[model samples]
Target: MWSMLMRKFRRFPVFSLDKRQWMKNVIHQEVGKGKRVIMFYVDIVKLTEVENRYGDVIAKRVLHIFERILPHVSRQVFEIRGNILAIQKLWGDDFAIYVSFGGDVNEEDCRMLSIHFQEQAEKQLNRQVSFVNREELRVHIGYAAISGQDIVKEMYTSVKRAAHMAKYGITSETYTHVTQFHQVLAEENVTMNFMPIVHLPDGETLGWEALARGPEGSPFATPSMLFRYAEETDTVFRLEHICRKRALEQLRYVKPQQKLFINLDPRAIDDPFLLRGEVFARFEQYGLNPYNIVFEITERHAISNYAVFRKIIEEYRKKGYLIAVDDAGAGYSSLESITEIYPDFIKLDMSLIRNVDVDPIKQALLETIVQFAEKVGCKIIAEGIETGRELETLIEVGVTYGQGYFLGKPDKGMGHASGQAMNFLRTMQEKKASVREEPFLFTPAMSEILAKTITVEKHVKVRRVHEIFEQNQRIESVVVLEEGRPVGLVMRFALYQVLGGQYGIALYYERPVSQIMNANPLIVTKDDKLDEVARRAMTRDAYHLYDVVIITGVEGEYIGIVTVQSLLDKMASIKLEMASSANPLTGLPGNVQIERELNKRIKQQVSQMVIYCDLDRFKWFNDRYGFETGDQIIVRTANLLKEAVMRCGSGDDFIGHIGGDDFILITKAAGADELISFLLEAFPLFFADIYEKRGLGEGAILSMSMAGVCMIPGLYENVEAIAERAAYVKKRAKELPGTVFLDERDCAADETHQTQV
Candidate 1:
């Protein structure tokens, strides 16, 4: 029959091999062509269970039956390998009969063909009498017609996913016959809506949570209904993809500082379609600060596979989008999720805060959750707050942030109910200012000038500056020069050695200048800035070997020593410089102080790391916890830093305040991680204890999240450049499930697997 068909159509396309191989190649090539190619991916339902129950021989026999029955129904086109049979039907099956009438088939025809194939295949399998299969056998079919390599790749993934859904359906006895992929697609109706989570206290609007509405105008508006249908119909992935795309689109319309919370299923992140770079491109086109968009991951479902999901989340987070563990404190592994994902914010489940004030158990639960959040560096956002009593109770419990209808409803447009947040910020700032007073930035040029010229003859006992040392015992070393040249250093050790040793008075009175005087004095120019001179002087190594850098003329004329005491005075002046520019919520300098420090650093040409530290949800914490508790949080954070510096950092590192909850740090790159780690470990201790003392249960503790960006030489235009990058990363960290994000020029430099002490 094959030879006759080939000879009669000699002028037409000819097959080079047997019917099966020829059909396989033809199908493979046809699917490869055109803007869109229909994909029909088929898999046996419960094949694993069938094989285990009936053995491999029975499975082979079933496959053999399929091989023999193909030719009777298929107008053999092509096949890929032995497993997949690609066929263009001329007759027998109704779907194949319809395919013969094709001139670029429409979607309606495609659907009909898919349905027709399932019906014919089922009937054919049922008729086979030789094998009385104990359990009815059916094929789960998935199909997608798409164009472009990207779409094709996505189609391939979707088809495989559809196959799994179909197989799962079959196992449930719901889908007994061959299932068409379009059946699943038909059930998905992508829609979007919004709900607002408002701030309490002053009743200001902060942001809206984007909600997913299933099917046009359906009563099943809750997210559960939408997702349940998706799981039932094998369309969850598609529905999630559509909703995410819509949420990103809606972000453009949201008010510029207000955040938009998008609820996401953990499974949604695993979708290959959503992971494309084009999705991010669309987000960027919407003018969204990915950081401002919060992804709410519900903890209701068991997260069995977190490795891949976590990788996807980390990538998205690095780009600036924030992750929120929603309905936390209610899920089985809520605390575990908090630790694993390190979310920027944990939204307390309504169940935990429903009646926190009256119920000590609920209060204790909330408090524990809040404390856990603090320990992990996550901020708490109380959800489902509906009454004034609840609000007052939350405030008393020291909840960091609150979100509920009682606070504000989610709206379609921007511009929140006013006067609340602004007034609150103003009041807080005033209080902050009252507590902190600015310090004077005393420059050496501005300090009282001391002028004296005392010449030392060749063998003279040069103890002439004993009075200077007596005035300042902090002075560690002094320089001795000869004819406009640095020749020796007079260290405290040298003076004490001579005074107590065997050669005591003999050396002090008779020793020549070269013989007794210590050679190789550290020297500096008169023009060297005070900070630079101070930095060198503070080093014990510099003091012992060559304490000071001698000031010189063009001809190397000896000037004076850059003593350690002078450096200490210089540091004190810089601190005063910082105090002058601060915002009082924190003793740290404000943005203005940052500018000055950056100016000084750039002018001095010193290697420094510009650390931008921001307290995550500090404003909300203040609002809920009262200004006093908030102040304590700030004070505790400052003390943690001071202690951290005392324990881990050398004197060379400079930690400055950038005001409120923001801070600045200038230090060697090597110290960045250590300092950050120390603060991270130490902060929770102080935060927890303060909250405990305030009777904020055990959970309402204060915590901080930070972004530490390394200053790349020439990459930074000014301090603002470093500050901006650091701030951006800190924002990103606050959005993550954790409290600290250290942006060391490149985030990758902070290895994910490596633990830092």
Candidate 2:
């Protein structure tokens, strides 16, 4: 049964074979073409021992199996780079294979390739042959880069010598790593840790990124060290599979709506088992949905042929498993990988996210990346967010999600951001979300007004709905259910169409209530914003518009309902409260709320700015121009303050009107000067606009002045102290020329000058 090639090889001795010489000449010719040839020299170790123990028959059979194994392994691993140029036996049980590349060998690439082929080859042979254990069946693997430049320099000749140098270049430490890594892969000595990737604004764990850890208390405990060993030993796929299996085992505990991110090597696509849908079976066995799985293709792995690789992963994408590119900003291949793969998520590098608050260049780069990610329909997940400032900056720059030691560390079980980090995110999130038309800081959801809704299964008789409605007059509506999800709505008035008629009760009472229920009633989630839910509810047609809005949890399990009556009442109440609290003219926060806001900011000990704005000639103009014209002027000043705050300050900034011609603005200390400068520059134009609007002659003049104080920690405990200081500064500011801004520096200079006098 031996193949013709095996029978032919037996006919000639090593020296008589013309193939070896022919291969060498072909390689030299390739080098002459200015291409680099990577030649791998492989031979079976202890071949004579196998012959001594099992006789020549078994030894020859082992040789045949290894020859078959070589080609298969080449197809799996070697095909990534290119096809093997030739395979020739140099001597008995000794062989060599050559592959050509377009460019010279990179030292790093060469090192990785050598370990990859050698370690992976030995593993494959032991697995296929099974004649000996992994240690017993050793394959001596060596490789060399033969290039035109090296040949011209006479640096490399005799493929055996060149290969020996490349092979022996590996240090002794690699042997220890190989031994340790082989043990780890064989025994699956690894554990998985889960870290939460949180939504930055709410700190919600959108998904858990699985991190692989080696045996505890070992040198390989860290992922970098453990994976390094795997790389040196050429067991990346084996190691990746073990980590993957362990992570998937936790899928039973993960919610169906939450995702579990698994690290994947691009080379994993070459696995025959994966191509045959083996992982899909694993997911089915775990009772986990593939929709909740995400495969992270690390940017560290270099893809040789993206055209082919792209087609391979299309199957996984079609199966509802999302893809993420990790360590995006740390590698050269990140942009290419993003463009080629168009992944669902992009995990930014730790280096780029660290200290991003202070680096304008990094901020600009990240902003651009965020925009690019948005354009490509991918969400950005910033990694290694260690500081509060970094978190705030990322949110400001519009990175949607993030994870780091500051947010949460990896844990044995799924975890969330710690309480401390949660408070930080909550405060910042509130501040950022503060720019809204609603009166409250956070929007109320449908749950706020969820009514006690009655429910009956769809198969129930219509008589049941009638009984529930009769038992409780306040239960205006009943939700028809199939399983736990709502299928239709039955209202008190809907009963009239059926039961109000003469034969309505006897004819329809015994049938399924689904027949009488409104098949397509309004249904909103419990967490939906109340305003949006109300908008949707009000838009319904006349008959069903007043019907209850069925509220459900995120998974569509029916929770309760919000009647149109209660929803409108809630909306009216919110409007009434807003009307009472907001200023009549400017519609900004009034005196009571401004005092409360300033006191709260003072107690928080945060660095901020309190700006007091006033008009110098306003009293004279108000007396000459009627109160109506003066009101217009006050409104114009309020508009000017809003423009400065909106253009320069953050969303968390506070603006208020203080009676006749005075106003207040609170913003962060960081941009206080810029905001003040913008107001001073624009205030003069606004002042002129007021006079021009009334058709007043050019002789009229109005002067505007603003006083700003930078409030650092312990600067003032109460709003009274801030008000008194700002009042004095405002008095000083009114003494200056038109449109002037005075800060702590100017106040200090005046006090110093007065003391010197």
Candidate 3:
């Protein structure tokens, strides 16, 4: 067998009995022509044990089986050892094989051949050697390949080293005995994609988050596998370089204001030769601003050498690059990293935002983060807003920016930035204004719009005042109180653009709020009609009447702002409360209210079917997009869910948002399937444009797969549980490529177990 011959090749030279002189002459001539020679040294350690167990006869038969396949796999096995051929099999289960290759042959071929020989040898042995007691047979192939000019002994040593690697690979289970080792590398391929992060306030997309993917149909189909491959080959640095370059090249299509966020393994900072300039050069090639490329460094790995990392990060920052501490507050020393880096932005971890509305502890922590961000001149991006309730909580906590699936799912092309919601905001403001002749004016006695008056020391930062102004929007004007005396009022607009200007923080730091605060601003009594006060507010000059501040008592104390929009919103709320049955986000009545309405219809014996809605990868969106933008996404999606329900809704129809990104609708059961069909068709195209806008691609193609579960009364208990199950089924639907799923009625169909193609 080749295994026996390989060992002989390592320990002794082989010369043909009758043709030794001729073979030696040929070998010398080949060596003279500069060919490389690899001598394989194989030792069959199990041979003695095999002989002991099955006697020599059965062992010899197993060897004969190996001989049959020897020629079949000889070319590959021989070339893999650098063209070495087995001179002969030897005693004690040892053998010798020699392969030689000229300048024309690649060394890799010999490695491949060696792999094939081992696989065939193992398979042939396993199939034929029953009496040999397979476990007793162990063989090792050692080879050293070197240029003919090198001494044979040196060549032997080199080949032996390679054999060690092969032995290790086998023992460690890096490769199956029957599988070619080369195929392992061939199987792992890396793929990449991107997700958009849109800023809600201005509808300007902020950046794209580069996501890692792997080869389709390959076992290595996720970032984890790609990384594992890199680690295995010690080529992680090479892969990062490639990923960075590819992501930058793709950034050419992004909007100018938008940035490209690429994740960096912080451990890479210790790599002395990592080319930082090469990265910038790629950006230059694509004409992208260095400032627009933000590196999101995750803290999942411990940063062992802080001094080195700090130096490298500082060097990058000096070159107009921005740094963001991703997943802040998620792991060890997250806040410490933020403080150390003084990042331009802090991305709150999604876990902190999940179900935030119901968690008081979470709200307090978030508020603290916001306050700290204000002090440090860093913007806070809350990650993961998936429900209206959560959005409302974030808004109340003074968070201004966020992103999540609730905002918009990542797509392969262009998608819109909720065009309908923007238009709705503009339209509703006007519609409500025109409908009421008296503008639904509210007297102070009926409205509780009082504000708090704060006295600050003269050395307080103007930034602090601005922070207070931004957070409590109800404060129309601030009366700077110093030593119990009113020094001045701070105009809101003056502080607005200041934060974005040069020296903004310095100009406000350590300065009295009075320095920038207006003096003797207009004052109004709390007893005035709120709508009438809003009308008066429009006529005042910028300086003379900073903003009308209403005093709850006499002597012009501080109170909340009374605007026309607020009055209209308040009127709507009153109407909603009087109705006492609607969802706050989409203004639909509560389930109890809905049940009454539904029962009324059912009592009349009207047919109805319930449909559920759930956002797919909504969590991923929140993780990528901060919670602020996520809220906008949730609010918009809630409206869209309502719209979809209404489009198919009848007098017996109902819609609701089940806390987060879950929804339900009850309609005529006969037409319920039709509603699912309509939604399945419309949702993707409706949102694809937004993805394109964010530069994921030309026309955003969302991966928000959806599925609906038909209402089966006995299948679930109560309306809440029914809605929960339907939404759960919808989530399973979203796992597939398309956007729609309806739980099939066939007995053979199970929506939950559907596969994604």
Candidate 4:
């Protein structure tokens, strides 16, 4: 497919020195054929700095990843409008694509296409590659539509001019942040935070890792955002120097015998202060012991040459400092670094530690790493142990040390782990613990918990609503509908408060319900995720703070309502389920967050896919087989979906449970068929064992159903549209027998082991 697409348009595998001439030739040819030409200028923002700092190898690798994903993303984005005539590198880290549109294509069309393509391409770059650092691989795309009057020589120049305007334009976010970045550096506004690293076996504070922050409320306040700007602006070393200096200044709070773990990026390993012995000079002034300092080497910046890195590390070792690899399992080169550096400690990445208690694979991996650490004469420290189960699991796995928000959050002052968590672990070590439930790990949709509240049409008199409220004192709210669609809401408390006032009822008794009803009541469709719904519900002003949320169907028809009480109850259940799940490393986003993200992408008008999933005959299966067996199937379904996504989707793709027997997946439309093919192939096959376990034939087992909504440019404005279509398709999929998928666009059902795509 890629080859075919490349063939359709002239393209080079790499940036060529003669790219300008190549692009000009393509532009001239396309224009000669009566085609209106457009130019796309692509850049890996500040990639030259990356080349200078990390060397050409890393920079070239970044380019290679960028080059690989561009064609695929561009083809998906540009497929709707025009043909990509040619794609070639015109200069260092800057590439151009010549697109041929019809004579009727206007500049506005080109502008929108460029903006959408840029947003998507940038998002793809960050997800497609195992990026070098937390700094995302982002691109700045600028484009120009060639006018018939323009010379071919000016085509490339136009795109470059657009690129310049976009990058340095007064409204550019980078420009604003860069200005803020200068002020931050000039003011020396960095703050240091230290989070406790506990000895897991005893839950004792073993050390504190120093974390840096910019000024509060500034764009660079968050460490990730701060350092990302630093990398882009070529002030990484300068920023690190300042952070290290600030970190050292906090040594006054360091307890004797407790190590102070300082983060040291590989790019900043050779900082001028470090080479000049200035950092060493500050240790004595801070009354620090050399052995009490541990340099936590981040894996974000890959070590290009280990031999040189080993020599550098040895120099630090000679100064009586210890070395530890940070985020050992997350980065591309962490494991290799472990064997090469033989550091004093390895901080297992959160990806490995999240939900480690429940995952046998993670436990096995952790146990293996623990054994290896012992052989290497180093300790294994688990990071991001957010729950007691995780902490206890680390202990059982023989991981001697740990760090995370659960252990202790980074703070201005060094703090200790919660006494309750520590005590719980101690007791569990001596005896078997009871299975206790945490809050629910998954958010429910309104369908799972919507209250059957009374709804009235907008024409109903306010007096009638008041009488209804008075007769049924328990009804806290009423949804006002017009033409069967919800138009407003009336809260009982607010209504009564007004009516209880002198002559309040006589003044407006016969008025339409809309007069007093909250026209802007917090409303969500029944399919919306509850967590996001609750957030929106809570954001209401104090007057309507506890007002019930009006729930509606896709067409705005009033369905029911979820009062504050019901939302809180579901939330409490979620909390309990979370505690009960024995796993705190959650991977799903809340519904609102999911919608927010999907809608943002949808507004870009790029093609994408949203798959709504359901388990066929789930209710019947759960009733006959009981909750335990039903849960096992749910787990299997989740695992299968995850496998499909991991195999066919990019890093940014999403799979989330939308309550009982329902799930949602969002991915690039280009990969939708592949992902669907994978799930169609895997789901029923993986669940065959459950049938055998229940003494039933494979043909009689509970199966899977997926309703896919393929969103095309301008076809679906938001995730809500996708959901609305998916909801319809889901019913169709469920109506059919066995594991099957129904795409709203295709209007065809894919049965078990038979992928339509």
Candidate 5:
């Protein structure tokens, strides 16, 4: 039947192999006759939906409806090639028809023909498929006149450009054209750009997020425009599938072990082809592993059926593919989806991460999310980190991973982190380690307290060393170094004693310093803690206790020297400062001291408890009673906490006061409950005497309300967040008329009333 139709329209042939040659010959013949050919590129827009809903059989029938209607418009037909034909079938629901006319052919005639063909095709297809809606069968037609010198080239370019424009609702008499989503997909004109996701603290590349861009200078060039058009036309699945394949094909540009995060619309989760291991096979074909691929589900729409969606995710997980909830906090349904799916990673929406360093509210929200992630065993990745301050803030809040322009922008290669970011990470890490190791002690290393000492090579003459000591009267010791590393120390008195002997000068003069110098001098690294170095110095032999401690770098390179007296002075000063920072009445640490302790614990990433204790109605007691009695009560309460910590807390436990009736207790998570219980049971006994003396009943006396917040370090930004949350929980405890309350939500506990004791 198709062959007979071709014979009737014998001027043009319809065959897969010769379609291009047929178009070329027809355009040449018409132009050779001095004729103007108007080419119409007709594409069926709803064929994809038809294919998806009814099967290829019904979809082919619909395509034939276009084929039949096109002959009525013009006898010359040409089929477009590539993906437009390969996947769509036959003409792929897209074809071009040319009509040769004289120069007198007008625009009005072309318009009328276009309108008639569209209306007639719709009516005929609808009549044939009575069960389908007429609106479901639609076509887009674009036409351009060809009269240029190179008719084949001009006609092909003009008609293809017009078809692209018409598909996206653009039209013009001029040859200017706009590219659309369908044309882009049909031509496979999209490319993938990758942005690195890095570990914030060290700037190590963890993975890359694949981003898609349409052809350059096209209307759908940008990712936003391309994706919007795809969604509008219901071609998102096809477009995304192609993009994922392209991204995987370029996996050779990335490290094999690094993760590849591909953005996928939630609808893809329901796609049968995608779920049947097609994508898995593609990954394997490209030498990639499913375990390293993270399908970042872009939650632009809510999951209508969570059970089915979860089942699909479970299937992916079983194949070793990880799931990430993208753009978290951008919409209301994101958190709900996260709760339902429990994704392995949650990407914080840029809105929350932008300028977070300057915004306390954002920081608080991030802290809450970090705490939540810890409880759910999920990692939090902060996206759109555009500045160093933002990255620093993310690190401070313990964001597990980060991706932004500041770290590295999206490009087409396996890229490393920015040099600036890596250096900053190293500095921050070193500073953090220093802070954690030192805590309240300022043990100046040998590098910091190095006393000026003359250094000589082991080969230096004894006469020269003696003259050096004689010239510098204050020089108590001389260091002997070979190549930058200290090998021996020579004391001034011992050197003078040796030289004072009758034959000592004759024996040692012009000899190497190694013979006269103490070969095994005390040594310490530049990073050695001052307290530790001091302990080593004191344990040495009494004669060598005052000798200098040699400082060396990591490679055993000589740096400087420190005396025992300097180390003793620094330790005494640090102890004095700590003592002065403690609360005078209770002898417990104050706010400044508490913060230092908290910072140490947080840097170590240890699980600890922050208990905020407030004496309920203590202000009333202070008002009714004298200041002396109030002081006595405060002292007694502090003593009770100290005693309980001694009994139930580890030696590392810390007690502090925020001043007045508020106190803080820092202990291990294991010991926190025990400590809180002890305080609750013991506080009433200590308060009973005060109530009796005031002639007040037990109910009227001020009770202690303790709100405990237990968390691992790095889950919070700073000690302030810990204090603020504990205070909030303390307020909730007071509201509930309970003496003990625990914020057991493991985050910023909101359901405090239910967990009261």
Candidate 6:
């Protein structure tokens, strides 16, 4: 009789009606006052279908179970009704709860609460509703934290969007994709790999591009698959957020002054976390400055509104973050984006860079883009360079930077170009230097020649100085200093001579050495050239010629002492190396020397002009004339070129005989044009004399064609690319009649010049 009475009263209301209106008003008021609110949107998976299949009794029982358990999840829980317009459109079949927090709230607490409520609801619903071959009822929970004032609509939309994404796993056919995405989120499985963007000319790394990767062997293992699935499921914002966080975390190991490139999807820009200071804060946590970060705005998807996008990019720029327009030339929209935004870096699409070495059309297109970038004052980074030829071609075409398998593959750590990439760079650099004929000049400074020596104060006891000479048999001299300035020199033989005499120790052993010190010694600054110092040492009196040379700084502070033997040794070594590297016929520096000079200039960050000079019709002249006569002509031309350089260029300017009719000259950029013009005028006069002496016809006279390339050291990676460009300009010069000078300083300049032979 009790069981029958309870069944009759089972239909009575067990919970209060949904108070969505009251909850909405409360959320609005709290949000308006800048209080933090968290909204948990909970949806019963296929609830309507479950109700139809299992009857009203079971559906009502499932709702009653959620109402009883939600109070345990949070003290500020409120039931959401369908009356609120924003919540109604987004909530759909999902039941919503508003949880407000005062002061502070832990994100982990909210996550645990959502999980507990979902599990409890599922357990109760599964027990009450069952059928043949029926799927178990489950709950999908989505939550978002909202702060600041008057964003109730945005708050609801964000939570509702998250819920819809959470529910997609149950309703969509690709359940595995959804499940894997959630697992990644829970486990934080997203990670980043870095690929180096190297300066192609020198193989120096400019920066690394951070590439995102998901868990291995999963459907979302690759960035393309992962982002595509996220976009389809409306979880792109969350995925991008996780990716950015991981990228920033991995940047801790990056070297100082090296840039870090991080990709950002335009659609994810609206995320509150991204818009607020969260991303900047994360960077700060990793000790990364905003100036070192470059936000690569990827163009994989269309940007719906460029105005809004530009505004966001401008905001980031104002905070010292750089912007790069990625995948340029991939589509018209990317071009439009770059034009509208004027990014700091424009990355060329790999499609255009592929096989560029063999395809003239691709080269032309790349050349055009490089010109455009130069005009806009943006650097061009060629992407996907996979071969040596492609890298060489890019460098030849004046691309400032590049990244691809040819340089380095993406790895889990900061890596540099290796294997084939390093070998290719070295090989090209060597090839560029193969034409030089003179040994490179290496002048050792006083610092390198100085020998570490013992010094004594001017007032030291004579007995102690005598003991020092006796302790070290090889000691020739000791420096006496007043403070840090060298004032006197004490010779070991002189001290020994005075101290070895009878009664010498008793007479003067305890006195200060200032009485016996020479008070005059050879002193040279550290900046003094080795050769000059050696000459000064040789000019000393025969007895004192072997005395140590005291070295000092600019302020006259004693540094160390140098022996005559070390100076002679260094000078000998330099002479031997120079002799071995000089060209036999021209007696000038060769390839090895030229490369060393170029590297030194680059290291010193000097601005210089490199000129490639070739004699037109040299091969014909050599073939027609005897070998000896041809050699004579080559020698004569070298002499005239050297004369012109010495007359018009600085003493530090370099001249090299690159074998045969080719020569190289490195000089200051300001005087390079004048030097070339002088050579153009001087060479003909010498040729005229040779022609008159040999009784040769006008056909026998060959004119000189010079290609001059002006460069600043940091602007290029290596000398090979500069050499290649000079060769190209030389080829263009050969096309014109008579001796012509071609200027390829502006890479985009048209090929036309008016110069006489």
lDDT of 1 by residue, 416-464 (tens): 5334433543454444433433322323421222222333433445354
lDDT of each: 0.56, 0.75, 0.56, 0.73, 0.72, 0.72
Native RMSD of candidate 6 (Å) = 22.8
lDDT of 6 by residue, 263-320 (tens): 8888886555543556645544554445567788888888888888887776665444
Count: clashes, candidate 3? 67
lDDT of 3: 0.56
Candidate 3 structure, TM-score to reference: 0.41
Q: Write the per-residue lDDT of candidate 5 for residues 87-202, one digit (tens) a residue.
A: 11125777666666665656556655665666666666666765554365766776666665675576556655556555753233322223335457766888988899997766
TM-score of predicted model 4?
0.37
Better structure of 2 and 4 per lDDT: 2
Q: Write the per-residue lDDT of candidate 4 for residues 541-581, one digit (tens) a residue.
A: 33456778878887878888887888988888776654554
For candidate 5, the per-residue lDDT at 61 reads: 81
Which 10-residue span in candidate 3 carries the lowest summed lDDT? Answer: 437-446
TM-scores of all candidate predictions against the true structure: 0.44, 0.47, 0.41, 0.37, 0.42, 0.47
Off by over 4 Å in 4: 1-166, 275-277, 432-757
